[model samples]
Target: MSRLYGDPIEVWTRDGEPTQFVWHDRLYLVRRVLDHWVVAREWWKTSEGDPGERRFWRVEASPGREVGSYELRFDTAGSGWLLMRAWD
Candidate 1:
């Protein structure tokens, strides 16, 4: 199972791929990208706002300990990035 935080994070990317992200005051380096996909906005779910497409990444990351997988989402409408879930 994964926990959802929806917290905004700062990410560093290389060649259009995420390499690292800052969360909970720690830097987690992405060791591997497990998967990636795009989620289109659900128009019915938004009555007042729409953010377009959201890109997600399932990655294995490490912060000087045992590596763990995480899910991240990037909002294309300028809402920035979010650390959606994490497997610890």
Candidate 2:
């Protein structure tokens, strides 16, 4: 897995599942969802911050002909999405 860190991305979802994502000016279609989970905010990290909950998805996708695995995160507080990592 490689870190994309917190790179923001545009995603297309259906029935709450990520169907595709646009990253770095390219679009990748999700072929499979390897895993999905939620992480609670670490309230202890900042006394005045409410980072909110995060939902994560590990998926397999194809940008072209080759399929690869990637991880994406959704911030519930702001409804923002991030590409967390890619296993290439």
Candidate 3:
């Protein structure tokens, strides 16, 4: 899929679990926390270090009734945030 520039997103954790996320540029609040998870993978093809990994946070929101997750990639090269996955 193609993404526009300057998209807004959020990342959070549930019950002290790893971080998760919801994607949106508009301001909003979490009416209630549902669930959260994390995803980490090695990017050997794009990595240039001993351990090049990407981290993601999957979260379920209530009010919006949206499901998906946020991403946080950490590698010897760099780190950044992204919208990993989403569903209705």
| Decreasing TM-score order of the candidates | 2, 1, 3
- For candidate 2, lDDT tens digit of each residue in 1-88? 4766678999999999999999899999999999999998887764558768899999999889999999999988778999999887
What TM value does model 2 have? 0.86
Clashes of each: 0, 0, 0
Give residue 17's lDDT in candidate 3 (0 to 100): 39
Write down the TM-score of every candidate: 0.85, 0.86, 0.40
Clashing residue pairs found in predicted model 1: none
Error of 1 at 48 (Å): 8.6
Per-residue lDDT of 1-88 in model 3, one digit per residue for the tens?
3333333345454564334444455433344334434434455655453454444333443334543332322222444455544443
Better of 1 and 2 by TM-score: 2
lDDT of 3: 0.41
Return the TM-score for candidate 1, rounded to 2 decimals: 0.85
Winner by TM-score between candidate 3 and candidate 2: 2
Candidate maximizing TM-score: 2
Tens digit of per-residue lDDT, candidate 1, span 1-88: 7888999999998987799999999999999999999989886677657748899999999988789999989988666999999997
